[model samples]
Target: MKEKFALGTALLVASTVPVFGQQYRAGSSDTMDQNNQQDTQRGSCCTSCCDECCPPKDPCAKCAQLWPSCGPDWIITPGAGPCTADGCDFFVTAEFLYWAVRQDHLGFAVTLPEPETTSVGEISHPDWRMELGFKVGIGWLTCIDGWDLYLNYTWLRPRTKNETASSKEGFFLQDYFLFGFFGPPGDFTLDNETAKWKLDFNVLDLEWGRNFYISKCLHLRPHFGLKGTWQEQKYDITANATQPRGSTQFFDTITGSADLKNDYWGIGPRAGLDTAWHFSRCFSVVGEFAITALWGRFDSRAKATQTLFDGSVTPAEETTTTIGTGSFKTEFHSVKPVMEFFLGFRWEDWWCCDEYYTGFDIGWEVQWWGGQNQFAFLPTETRWGDLGFHGLTVRARFQF
Candidate 1:
């Protein structure tokens, strides 16, 4: 009985030792797993904080490295980009404009169909007025450092009208008059007469130039160009007569019409300087001044006609008659000078894109030319005149 009891106790002790050993091994594994999880969480938090606080180096530095000549103090240039080998350095500009033309003198004629005519008397300079005009221009640029080639063209047309009232007693003939049936010069007079005048003026210009940048904010351009100007002047005078006058008998009234025309073409060289003051990255004030020297051709002509009215008939019977018609043409050379100035605001990188720009400008311009000849009624007598124009200009431009 004692041997069986001792064997049973040894078997129980052995079983209990194995169970305790298994619990110790399991606890060691769980502690090791917890330490690893804590370490992983700490590492993740440190990485995120560093990323948020730190900034990377500039990417432009890499560009500088590739192009060492750009230097350390490099700034991105406006208006044009750096030169590249693939030919991306061309640009174009288009503009629409309105100009308010000031009154100008083209030419004046004293008489129509020279040599003194019985149908018409002496005339003086007619009053001229100008209306609003429109213009369009296009420009192209080919860039190479500070040097570039440029071309531009502009056109404008303005309307004018005038009227004058004079009594037949106030009418006079020119001193050089030769042939007239109304006795002597200044002796002929029409009764109750009025005169009307109309004029049209047009101008066109085309130029090509090379640009030289004096600085980042200034430039000088020298150009050679062509200009064309055309003008037409018309006059009409009407008179009421109750009786006959000097060999010619008019039953009722008479109307006289006169037309004068001129054309001028010029070729010349011009030079200008342009400057800008920038108040912001996208806004600027600009000013420009230019002078030109031109060799020009001027052409002039004149014509006249008359119509008789008979109030004795119903609806006032009318008889059309060309009392006298004559044309005089001459070619002469002259010089013209021009000046212009402007101030405006500009918006760059239009539509949030770097390739486009738009701007507005208000300015003034003046142009003058000499050696214009005016045709008179007497072919022997011609008057020399000068041309001048001064005006305010407003323009909107777009560039790409």
Candidate 2:
């Protein structure tokens, strides 16, 4: 009887052990599914983009900010004065410009005839002084699929004055040399020369663009626009010759004056890219590049006059195929290409319930206008020289 009882108890215990093990395993599976569901819910909370940006292996706590497309940087937004996070509607910008002009063709005087000295044949370049200018702009952050509109005006008027004295045996550079040929000066030896150059720059730009993120830390703004420009340049020089290279006799004084002007008005298409890499919530490094193709009219004229001590005058003026093909003066209708570049660092922030915005930045900018230096057309064959400007720009912006 005892042996039968022991066998029955062992069978019952074995059956109960297997049943308990099945139940525990089923509970463990259900618990694991619940935990997985919770983790998935937590990780899917990031709303910055459409695709699932969170990694499966990462902790749920970091899922919100660990977007795969974005690095540790924030997107730069161009919203109004107080509202920028979601989308901006309007903003205004103003910039202070301290710039200098670089023109390649304005050579007024040359020193003595030494092959070793750098100044022997080199044309004297005037001091490129920095002048103040201003730019004002208004933009609309449409928030319509992140599109924006901008209109702005820029103005600058800068001038440079220079004076040069030549050695007793050196002649002043003939005011305007002929294309492919630099001929002799009117006088044998030049004593002194004075020159003044002035420029008037006016521009209006209208752009349509959209800003978006390419990566977590980088953003790009691609833009297309119309650029209109009306600019004028004037260069005038006066030279005096008082000595002869051969004879020591008191030479008859010869004076020369040249008036040169180049003016243009054009309207064209402009395209550009603006980029920013944000390292912090409110600070970024930025760059911009642009190109313009202009279809417009250019008017260039130069007149040279020589006065002798004997009350005689000699005047120099001529027409070229490029200048007077269809017109009465030295003017033409053509296309000009211009390029611009900028790089800088900026700080921007928003407060007051994300309803206002303010920003500040400083940058270096350059603009190249191909074949824009038309100051010498007549008295010399139609030759072209490139013109450019480079300098510092400080900008302040606000949104409302």
- Candidate that would win on TM-score: 2
What global local distance difference test value does model 1 have? 0.46
Any runs in candidate 2 off by more than 4 Å, and if so which? 1-88, 114-120, 168-188, 243-251, 310-329, 377-380
Model 2 reaches what TM-score against the true structure? 0.70
Off by over 4 Å in 1: 1-97, 100-130, 168-188, 191-254, 306-323, 341-353, 370-378
lDDT, candidates in the order shown: 0.46, 0.68
- Residue range 165-186, candidate 2, lDDT tens digits: 4554433343333211223444
Worst lDDT run of 10 residues, candidate 2, spans: 318-327
- Let me know the TM-score candidate 1 reaches against the reference structure: 0.57
The per-residue C-alpha lDDT of model 1 at residue 162 equals: 47
Per-model RMSD to reference: 19.1, 11.8
